[model samples]
Target chain A: MKIKTLNLALAASMAWGTAASAQTEIEWWHAFTGRLGELLAAQVEKFNESQSDYRVVASHKGNYSEALNAGIAAFRAGEQPHLLQVFEVGTATMMSATGAVKPVYEVMEESGLEFDPEAYIPAVTGYYTNSDGQMLSFPYNSSTQVLYVNRDKLEEAGIDPDVDLSIWENWDEVLTQLKDAGVTCPYTTSWQSWVHLESFSAYHDVPFATNANGFEGLDTELVFNGDIQVKHIDQLGEWAQEGKFIYNGRRNEAGANFRAGDCALFTESSAGYAGVKAEADFDFDIRHLPYWDAVDAAPQNTIIGGASVWIMEGHTDEEYTAVAAFLNFLSSPEVQAQWHQDTGYLPITNAAGKLTEEQGFYDENPGTEIAGLQMTRNEPTDNSKGLRLGGFDQIRTIIDEELEGVWSGQKSAQVALDSAVERGNQLLRRFEQANR
Target chain B: MEKRVIFKGWMLPALLLMPQIVITAIFFFYPAGQAIWQSMFVPDPFGLKTQFVGLGNFEYLLNDPYYRASFLTTAIFSTLVTVVSMGVALYLAILADRLIKGSGTYRTLLIWPYAVAPAVAGVLWMFMFNTRVGVVSWYLGLLGYDWNHVLNEAEAMGLVVAASSWGRISYNFLFFLAGLQAIPRSVIEAAAIDGAKFWTRFRTIVWPLLSPVTFFLMVVNVVYAFFETFGVIHTITSGGPQQATTILVYKVYSDGFVGQDLGSSAAQSVILLFVVGVLTVIQFKFIERRVHY
Candidate 1:
């Protein structure tokens, strides 16, 4: 009886060993949870099913910031996965990690895959590419800032559903109208610095920082306290004081109020479409991010906000090949179109946009095309391409503090912006010194 | 007069002390030493290269206004958390002790919150005070109070202190209750027979007897507020509404993990270690003085 049991255990062990060794495993750590995580898992399942030689295993490693930390810690422990998903703000940090990352261009070239850099949207890929015009990471999910309007709330507030919110002057009038109509929170914004400041600078074709928004060199100084930027922030501060604008917690905490149909207008990432569409019972419309008419030819373009997948170092060449194949599968037109349509993230590739258009997916979803159009509206200027500043996340926190000062009525817009610039410059100097 | 059981041979003593020494070296001293070593060097985010900055990181921290502000924030936050939590816990412990019939039931109910994670407790309090949907905020709004912590620094600090204290009250309650129950019944009865009022008995007898427990809990609660309440601050405000609640530990995390400034973060940790050390020393001195009484 003992011999029989031992033989059965040995047979089971042999079977498991063969099954596991039959396919090479690719570990992918991502920040996405909820519906996005489900979609990522589904995509990985399809990839694994399509190719029996390689199995891609995807893991949710907390939020964007936490996932980036996990990757760094894992790399230090020499146990990093084959791929890591990092938010856009960490682009500079990832690029500066010299030997810690394997650029996507190198991965594709080494895998002998027919890779075309032009297949992706310039604006989407531009944010993740190096100065040499080489792609550093796969633009997995990119979102541009856009305005969300509750049409029902607008009608109730005695305002036109089609009221032009394209320019700040019109937006100001609308906000006042809503306030006069007794709306408590007529306007609130998510990602204040991103939508109001970063995208604001880019849309007005103004430099947020010197050195072409930190792309030219690391010795960049914050120039976001520019006249136009100050003018816009000053208006928001005035509105805040007047109770027309509600100050929500930093990030998308205000999205809840807007989705609850309490706030009439929300300036948030276009990706908020997924949540707003699901939760909001009111009829809503997506519009271009409001611009300052004071600038020459207003609304240049809004920069990206979501994350991209970067290939980490210390993975075997075999694993790199697997990662490249997985990336290719992800970027396929059909898959990209489906992902874009499902998640409201802008399609990374022009082919996916065209495919979605040809399939009438955008036609069915009227507001979905706005994000893509907003990103590709014009040839991106040096200022509008994207920010690539080391220690950008820290700078954003500093910006949040100063902006909070304005909202809390503690300081004027100019004072807050000036402080933000001075503090942000110090961090920039520190980052430069550390890296050098 | 101290009880002594000195081992006759050095070999046996070393063997007996081996486990504790190993644990301290591995769990405490080693990582702390690493942090101290790393504090003197700045590494690029990729960890490919590092430069010896000597005391550069510490000097920068001392000069950085935000870092200094965080130190003050930590001081205010820990004090508020320790006092509020211990005060409430002691009050509840006394009430539970007075309830002779179902004291165990009340004790169990009060202790349940300690089982909750600090982050979860933060979320729970956050939900109750959330500007849009929070019951407390909505009620306050109806009363024309306009409870908006997102923009209100005082309210933000209040919310974090409440959340941090709420979780710790359960822990403090357990200790206070144990101390209360450990008191001799005859002594309290004799005080009652002497016509001493409840407040007077508690003040003169129960309070002095509870001092040791109180002192121990103060140290534990201070450390808890300093280190363990990071989750509470992170979840409730992300240390914001203008860094009103950006405590020292949260800054260490934000700078180290989120900002990826390892050298600065390590330096912050080293300074924090020094602060904790000084606090512990002061606490021990106070405890020694109280012990003589």
Candidate 2:
């Protein structure tokens, strides 16, 4: 009797498996690794299991830049996935690739799915939308810059670990104190261009580029070397000379130093919490990114630095339906809330943020809500909506090179920023020509 | 004396050469032709539209000071990598040639680095001299030396050069060792009988005999340093410390692959191809005649 029951169950499972195999498969290539990558895979698995008609298969295609390149290469060769995750820097490039990407608005409208653009957080969604208020991509895993404080290191320097270092002036003072206490690395940062120039401009409500920071026109030029930007970098240059601030590299290399408790203070992406939480053995806290109190709209807001998922062009109608389903599944409040809480990325949808709050996640996690709150704190001005310059990835490298000169005492901040602006504008022009 | 094999029919010869011709066309000429074509126009990332701007990319690169600066950096980098790698390999090959006991182990160890990938070798060398975590930097710090390659231009250049040359030494070592062993022991023995010391024999006879191998390795190493060492530069310095280590090939990769500026990158590749072609021609024309063989 037991053998007969086992045979019957096996037959039933085989029948179900055959039925499942008939599901339309949707392919998604993303740029996530470690904890986030695992969460992304689990979400796909859940989505697939939750439905019987469509199966979304998620694959890690290297980091942000690599995935974007892969997506383009695939599209050129007619092998692109149904959806792709492109980092914020690639927004202009992807947007200009008019024949390659299917705008999210069209995808929703075509699939007859309910998608209110207003339902998503404006600060995050605004970056991927056009001037006509049409959403082009799904803003996924959005993160803003935050200050990571190694409390134990600060306390050892005879400074109160929680003494409200929310102003740049106060933070500057604490840096000196930490350095005086023989701290090797008093302060450091990852993504120098992002933390300094990009988010810095947004935080002060200054233009990083002309043409309303590239939202208004393709002929936009970079003007990040403004007086405010120069002054801030000059201050950082002075700090570097005084052995207060350390620049490890252009990317997130300094995150390792901070996570290892070598740096007392670090300015990095709020997404850095995932790594810091796992790797740090010291007492650490995530706090608001410091602002210069002198600026007119002081502490206006910060820009997001993560990636968005874009639907590609050229697919069967049935495949489009499957992609639309998976996208809706992704933006569903429960799934997005789980993603936001697990990865420390800002909740994309207002409903998800509300759900997370109602679940008491923010109250329980302490400081985990800082990223979402920082983004939503202010009504985003034209300057703070986020830069949409073409060839921004290359421009960031130019900024990095110039900033390296400042940090190394090779060039004054004025000269360096000037040079960066000049060089970056050339790239912007090239982007303009190509995109036009 | 040519010892050339003669084929019986034209059909056989054509068939034999067909595979190589096809491969060269597919792998080398096709991509090069595409680069030259792409270099003449600015294409949108989507491949939907391309704007013809003949020689525009080249004009921009030529005018760009950073791209111009990369030429000098490439020159300095390739020179250092070639000299240091060749010099160390020659010294080790000489030592191994003289060794009788444990010579196999010594030679094997010398050639081991050749097996390591360029990126892996870069990481290994970078790990040892890294400012934050490297043991060497730590020791240097203990000695009152602040070793910061990230901010220091000279240190960044030095780090990339060392990392690039470290793996290349094994390849040079193998060639040098083989060349040394191919020289008959009788000749060196005869020289020693004439009261010639090691230095005298090496300078007068062994050096002349090793000239052919040296010439071949120099050409190959120069080419390797120029095109291949970008991996080391990318892994260690990433062409920074304010473009102090921005070698030409690395810039090509940064602009084309990472930045997705196809026209600029393609122009850069075309220039690189021309450079390597000129270098190889210069070596064959001027330096090859000096080889004793």
Candidate 3:
């Protein structure tokens, strides 16, 4: 009996020995492809090589919407990954998933990791925090909207390549000049609702929806049909009629038109820089997103539009510790600076920005700092802080549909905006009922 | 005279039917039953909380104007797809039937498109008619005719229908060709001997004999248009340019999956199921009357 007991103890120790040698594996499902995806993989590899305690495996599930859907379905099937990268639009949906996700604060605290929520930039962190002012998710790749100017196209049109397009008035004149210069596609935009309405409202210090743009409560109502939004859209409708502004598809599909040198101006995400840099053979510059001169607080601040990493529940405490360590490694100043400089995403921490500046990276890249400066130019107002609403993706679709009506000359801007608000309110009500 | 099979032992027949019943119950009835059950309750995103709201989802959907508009869109979309695909397929099949040589080559070339997925077909069509950088659109622009489906409702609807029908024509052609080849040549010769031209012969004899195949293809095509062509619509137009192409199935998918509104999505599914059921029954009772067989 004594010999048998000793043998069993020896067997248990040997099993643990093999386990200790093999690092813990933490599955991370993200929604980035191309350059961003490669950068993410590199970050994971560096983290893995720097430590022997854990191995972080990063997988590209699909695009933003697909990845979020995969995570939700996986969680329901009791096989969710350790971490999920959810896009900015899905923030509200992720926040309301109660027990399905472990808050970042809780994860860090439980893992006994040294985490300071204040170390992150407020504008980036505020979007992913709870009502109690605790960070819920780790902001990874955040970007704000910016205007991309094809300088070569501008010069070809006989307009100044350094034209000031910071305001709608200046853009209107530039567009008219470009149109008269035989430019068929003078100006086009990607993410019409994002650049034209959502960020536009925030940049002009106007409420996109009530309840602080749905950040305060679930009972938020659609209020984007106010005078400011109507005027801006009305002006765009006139431009559409004049062949100055072209209406592309709902998503970032117009990036192709701009990158191919077929369009002179493009309002797209800051992260679009990578594609433009890679594809365009012409000179291009990044400009601040234009604002309306009629508004009292024009160009207040632009909000972010990118994904954040969330820790999924149903993992061991040991795995949670690994996740914390991995996120910490990702959030380090050197890593964040490299990611920001390479990807054109905003550095999530001020320390990273300072580090990048100290390294003279921004000075070398010229226009690379516009996105961060635009995001932090002024303190964010109630309207400027990022929108947090359920059914936001659907609402954006409705806005796209209604705006298409205006572009096609089927309905006036007022009528289209009014109809969109009515339709969007119904969706919001449905979402509120379900979540409440 | 109608032929009937008589079973001597009930056990043998029951056992034979058992597989089909089990398959249907497992594959169809089980998930459908769950959808119906879920339609009555609204669940939060996490499924952590749910509220029983019997008949509320249905009532809301009925009152919603966009849902009603989508009903009309689906009706128009399905009709166009069915007619366009079947009409083109019948024409091609007749042409192939007339050809003496290279008929096999033509049929094989026509059958190649059916292998492409619906989403892939959509992308192919979208590229041809894309607003910018499209070969066809550029030619059209050169001809002083602009084609922008991104903002044009009619163009958006036309693009999706063309794509959906383009992929489906191959399936319809296969059936129509088989049906056309099965028609006895002696009958056509006899009709020709009766002083009938090609159009007259086709109208009187060919169409009548092809009714059974036509009826089967009609039902199959309608079901395909209702359920399967969502990938085409989703990829090309996304039911967009002001919901002009927002068919019933796409709405159900967008609402349930993208919006995460499980109750509304389930309700839409139940309504779609009822629509397909009623449509099938109506086609049999109404359309099958003209079938001579």
Candidate 4:
């Protein structure tokens, strides 16, 4: 009798739940937290309120790496969500997982929605596009490496706050000045591999890997240990020994030191604006990532570093329609402009970039447009387009390990980067073998 | 003579053991078999294609310098964790056992740290040792010593071992306290009357008598350090500073889940399983003889 009543109650609840909403529910597993999470949630809420056809339920699924792993596990279990937010490093993995994901271009075509590939920023979209000229994922939150400086720290160190920090020659002098002024941590950085290696190679117009960074084929080799890259790291190693630059962890753990007003300068993602604005009390400014002035073709455009939204497989046709509609909504000029202005992420669409400019955002905020200017300043060569090597996440770890050896004075920069290239190439070959 | 109560029929005994047998088969044997099967093949991330390469993953792991170095790292890490945690717990247990008053409060206080999860303990220790903002490191900085575990291999290994051993000390403390309490007061008093000082009595009588518990804890703690301490390592060092702290279990996690190299991870797990099997066998066959119950 008790079991019968329990079943009756459960049946009633199920009926009531279905009766409550006729709208189709779309699940989006994202890797956003804190303020960015709130904004993403607001976007979903606004989309849901704007139309009654679909209710997008966006949930935070830890950080980028964790969210991708969750998606993989869920897909293996045949319970994947409708959409997943994957970091740029996982782009190759997701693209190779042909059975686990539905391409965004296909989803757009099937939804009968007004979708145009030309609308997205070229440098941002190029990273996720296949050789066949099809976009694999929706470029949701694109960011480029940017230098963040504490203006107060600069002034306190008796340096001109208006000095040009765009070039590495000037930046090195500034680092030395700050150190000479008794600054303990004159400079620090976050995402060392991303900023120093990937973005550095792009900004200098050097290939980070062969096969145009794996766009041509999967059989690519890591060639980031070239002369320019080695010289850059060797200089950074010298700076470390001289107390001009401080070595932080592999990831963004040094963001804390920068925000806590301990470091004078930081090289981090442009998306670091949100955290700087929220947690920092000192005056800070975002600038273009520095380039070595010795190189002839310096100051080439930097690549994107943020995540994209992937449509996972095993969802219904109706859900795919909703996903396409939501992606369109997210890329709308107004929404994209708002996201760019709010989070310091790049406006994935050219229209959104124009929209942000027309609203007088750059004029009002001095450093807000640096990321945009840096990315769009030059036509991206094959070298500056960005990398798409498989197992890049592990390769980055290997690079981090090698770089740590250099920073600790245990190994020379050349030797360390050579080993990194060798290790990374092994991973690349293994990836090529498996994916084939 | 021991009293034996036999079941009337084989059906009764079999029925009683069915639940355990079924659970073991489902949880343990099934996963072990799957891991072994998967180790022989490399699959793409989506499981779209699979390439069979029997023992190829193991061969690669053996040839890879990093994987071989990880074996040494794991040996060093487990030995340090077990020895440090057990030694500290035994010392504390002996101290707490000698106190005639407020022994309950002492034991309770000692065991409370066990309630904290390994991950939480790792985070706690990481915060305290953070180079930039950590209080302990800041104090160390004031003393003219730089504590940079991010680039310092020895420091990184030390920090992780300390964090991994922190919560385990509580568990070992609980067992040691119980074993000390279970010892008869008359034996200890008789030792003391025989002109044996506290140290001598503890060395001769208490230490030998406590061998059974010590032996049990050594095996348990070794296993814990091998498998369960991945949480601490994952939270603390993340097998960093040039793979200085990459234990075998941590490597397995990073390779499989983070790197998405399933076949290699499976091969690593099989090797880890064999190692633990050998350890358990050696402990039971040889060490058990020395342990008096």
Candidate 5:
């Protein structure tokens, strides 16, 4: 009996020792937490289970900024992960990383995976593509701004629940209706500088910056202080002063207010769907963002939000091949469709969209298709594509500060915008000089 | 033979200190040296390409209005927070010292704020001061004031400084309390027999004896005020209401990570290191001399 027990113990020890050394771990650093984090973990687990070749390990470094910083620091230490998720604002910075990254298209091609760049939605793919229309990063979770309406709140305010807050021909009509309905918090938005200034410019088919919003080159200049921007901000400021439009604190604190049904209308990213679905007890609908009637081409496609998975350099070829396989797995029609349905992010591939439509997701979940419709309805011009400016996050901060001044009645819209332009231009010049 | 024996003993002690010295050399001294080296040159994002610019980055920073503004703001923020925190902490320590009962409980309760991490501290203060749903805003509304830090410059500064000091005062209090307790009861008794009141007793014996602790706390508070409040400022205001709350460390983070101007950010970091170094040297030279210890 003692000999049998010793034999069993020896067998267990040998099994444990070999199991510890078996898995070839691939580090996937991302900027997701909460519900998104869970979904991401499930995806990693599914991928890990599907294959025995490599184990993909996902770590939440921090928010977008912190994750990017961690990736950069790790890269400098020669310890970068196989895959790093970078937000849209870091596109230009990532592009300028000379040899710190291996382009996704190149990786896919080198790995001999049956890859097609055209398989991705043009608008979604273009943001992370090179000038020649080659994808540089995998579009992991792409979202665009949409108007979220509290149907219950609207009905309570004696406004028609079916009223087309979806298509505001002009700001004048939006203000009139909101005032008539006595909406104390008619409209509030998260990422004001994003939805209002950057995406707003893109949606209006207006230039936000010179040099095709910095896509053409690094020497981009701030032009968001143009007439259209000034007029919109001034109108919003007026609404703010009248209590029709509430300016929540910077960041997404307004998300809670909207989810809690305090606000009648919210301008936020489509990825906010998960939070709204979970938190909102009242009926709500997502709609296309409202546009100004005066613009010749209103509702020109909105720019992408969320983030992309950039493959950092310095990993071995085996790691790259593993990354390519993981990305391809992520981009498969079934996986892409499920990811889009699970998170409010857009389907990156055409097949995923068709799959979603076939699944009756759009029909069952109204307004889920609005983002795709808005993005596809208009062919992207230079102004509508996206901004790729260096120091853009800092520039956004500057815009936020200046716009807050206008919102608080401290500075006029024109003055605030002009100061923002001047200050933002200085940052551009510094960026240009540094990168030169 | 005695000298040789002493030298042999010192050799072992030096050997014992080698690991720490090696770590400091590898981590701290090496990176600091590299930062200084990089500040003189322009390095690419990957840190591969380098071109010697020789003070070009410094010259640019000097000429740049935003950088200058950030520096001035940092100085003002550091000085104000340090002075205010030290004053408040000293007062609290004195009050706690005078209490004959439950002094330990008071001390423990006072130091509790320091136990919270900076990130949580930032979020907690942000929750309290946020305009839309903040409890403080509710109170302000009751008082008939439209209190929104996001739009008001003064309010933004006040909110950041208050949050920073609130988190920082506990450590200062702990130091001050310890210093207060260490004072001999005989001195206070002597002052009492001589008809000295509480204020007079504090002004003479207690104040001089606590000077060492006060000086140490001042240096610590200055450093904390300068570098440690970045998380609070980042969460609360993000240096908003037109860059009113942007201090040095926050600027470094913005310029380095968010802004992606690694060279400029490194340059700013070097300048901060220099500023902190100067302040530290002056504190040691001037204030340390006045310390009773």
Candidate 6:
């Protein structure tokens, strides 16, 4: 009888251990670090605290490229996380992974979560949404490129700190003012291809490529070597020669240059606000990107930077339910509003924006609304909507090379642009053929 | 019966090797075979649908100007970096060998860079060579050099090679130092009796004895320059100033991950493998025979 009781106790303990170990754990891989990483962790903690059925574990894989590569490698190894954060440029590649990804709208519908695509701000949602108006991915930490002004530098240069830089709609006027103020490093930009080429084409209402920048189809050719692009690049080349615009190395290396008060004006992403806010010892403000006022419809919306959350496939129904729950928690107004206010990323959903406005955050923080205002200023044309080109990141590298040639006087702007177009078209053709 | 039992005894050793054989099959051989397989095909970035086109990728790569440039660039970069680093490392190794006191301290200091991770090394070099805030750039400005890598291709390549050599010299120094220490005191004492000066002694006895170490370092350094500096190039230049620094491995990374042309990238990898394989085989056949020890 005593032996039977001991066996019962042992079996009961084993059963309890199994029950404890069976709490559906979901892995979320992201690319955020520092402040944004902390916020993400807090969000995950809140979600985990709200529920006892599932536990969400978020891991900082690496930077954006590293994280994306890790996710791809993990997927190939059949150990993919339930959620993956991919940058905006990786949208096409993520979309192509049909078997490897679970579309967010489908996940929401399958899990019976209260998901409304329209609840997301159209300007932000459209980037990650399909043509049929379905949310393919969850828009997280979306930002548009904007002009950052070092007010103290402007004031030091004897230029009016409040001098309506917003009205100087063209590069010519901006350059003139910068030159007049003796702003030697007045006009420097980050992500030169993104700011000068991608956003330039959009702001000028020109097609960066055919087939609606490959949103419609993959067989798109490079069309950015047009007259406007040439003229703009030539002018920038002239500025580079004059030492007014310096071409720092690629990828936000110039952010430090601008933040250190070495450069008066900077063309960088709205998300740069976080770093600049933390590091810059001087007062600074964000403004709408300057446009070529000569164009018919100048100052159209800018395209998005930052990244979105992608739901991977090959998980159980229970995991999908957990993903849906986590995503819903992420999209909640309170969570999103706090995230936007903290990170300088655009609030992805309309409810979040409304909630932020109700709290008068915009009134207190000037120019925080500029990015949203500029992106949604007009109904997005086929040209204005974000690029969906395959092999875009590589093409951007090519464009960067050509633009560097222009800056360095190795090639004329026209010659460089022509060569870049030709070279880039070959890639597009290859991409088209492969995809077909 | 005895012979049969001896043959059966070999089965134990064979069984012991099973795990390693399986691991190599799964990890190394499988990936290499897959790369060779994938090189013959074109893959869709989105669906990753691969279609075999047998030697098409190789043919295209041979014809592609960018690939050709990358090959030439890789060869030149590898050669320059290996030679320069070997020269500097040999000089430092000899200098440290002469030090009777604090030789260990000097050796430790020299080998410190080898202990740093490649990514950290890249970042460290970036800070030194950065255009705006780099100490090197700052000093160059004081010296009235252009110092702007954005505009100057020669300067950019020089900077990359210099940085690569700086990071690599430590490893070579360590090897050369060990080889220098192992050189017999009798050989050097005999040379001293002949009244050989420093350069004379170095050129005659020391250099010939160090040739074997030099040859080994050359092979390893070439491979390091080809593969290891890709991160530095990506971080520092992104193969910029008109594709001046786009070496083979950088192109492979850009093509595979950034370009999402996995087939073409794999094709490039196979080409790199071929080149490195040929070089390695040539080294073993010709160069290895020349090493004294």
* Tens digit of per-residue lDDT, candidate 3, span A62-94: 988889889988998888999999988888898
TM-score of each: 0.96, 0.96, 0.96, 0.96, 0.90, 0.90
lDDT of 6 at B79: 88
Worst 10-residue lDDT window, candidate 4 chain A? A14-23
- Predictions' DockQ, in order: 0.77, 0.70, 0.70, 0.75, 0.49, 0.57
Instruction: Please give the TM-score that candidate 6 achieves against the real structure.
Output: 0.90
**Model 2: number of backbone collisions:** 0
Q: Return the lDDT, model 1, position A258.
A: 96
What are the per-residue Cα lDDT tens digits for candidate 2 across B12-65?
999989999999999999999999999999988778898999999999999998
Q: Residue B282 of model 4: what lDDT?
A: 97
Give the C-alpha miss distance for residue B151 in model 6, angstroms: 4.3
**lDDT by residue for model 2 over A350-376, one digit each (tens)?**
999999999999898778898888898
TM-score winner between 2 and 6, please give it. Answer: 2
**lDDT, residue A331, model 2:** 89
Candidate 5 lDDT score relative to the true structure? 0.85
Q: Which 10-residue window of candidate 2 chain A scores lowest in summed lDDT?
A: A11-20
Tell how far residue A220 is off in model 5, in angstroms. Answer: 2.5
Regions of candidate 1 where Cα sits further than 4 Å from its true position: A1-22, B1-3, B291-293
- lDDT string, candidate 1, B1-293, tens digits: 99998778799989989999999999999999999999999887767788899999999899988889899999999999999999999999988888979877888888899899999999999999999999999999989998989888999999999999987899999999999999999999999999999999998899999888998899999999899999999889999889999999999999998889999999999999999999999989766577423
Structure candidate 4, residue pairs in collision? none
Q: Between which residue pairs do clashes occur in model 5?
A: none
On the 0 to 100 scale, the lDDT of residue A31 in model 1 is 96
Model 4, range B93-142, lDDT digits (tens) per residue? Answer: 99998898998898888888899999999899999999987899999999
How close is chain B to the truth by TM-score, in each candidate?
0.97, 0.96, 0.97, 0.97, 0.93, 0.92
Provide the clashing-pair count of each candidate structure.
Answer: 0, 0, 0, 0, 0, 0
Instruction: Indicate the docking level reached by candidate 1.
Output: medium
Query: Residue by residue across B237-261, what tens digits does model 3's lDDT show?
Result: 9999889999999999999878888
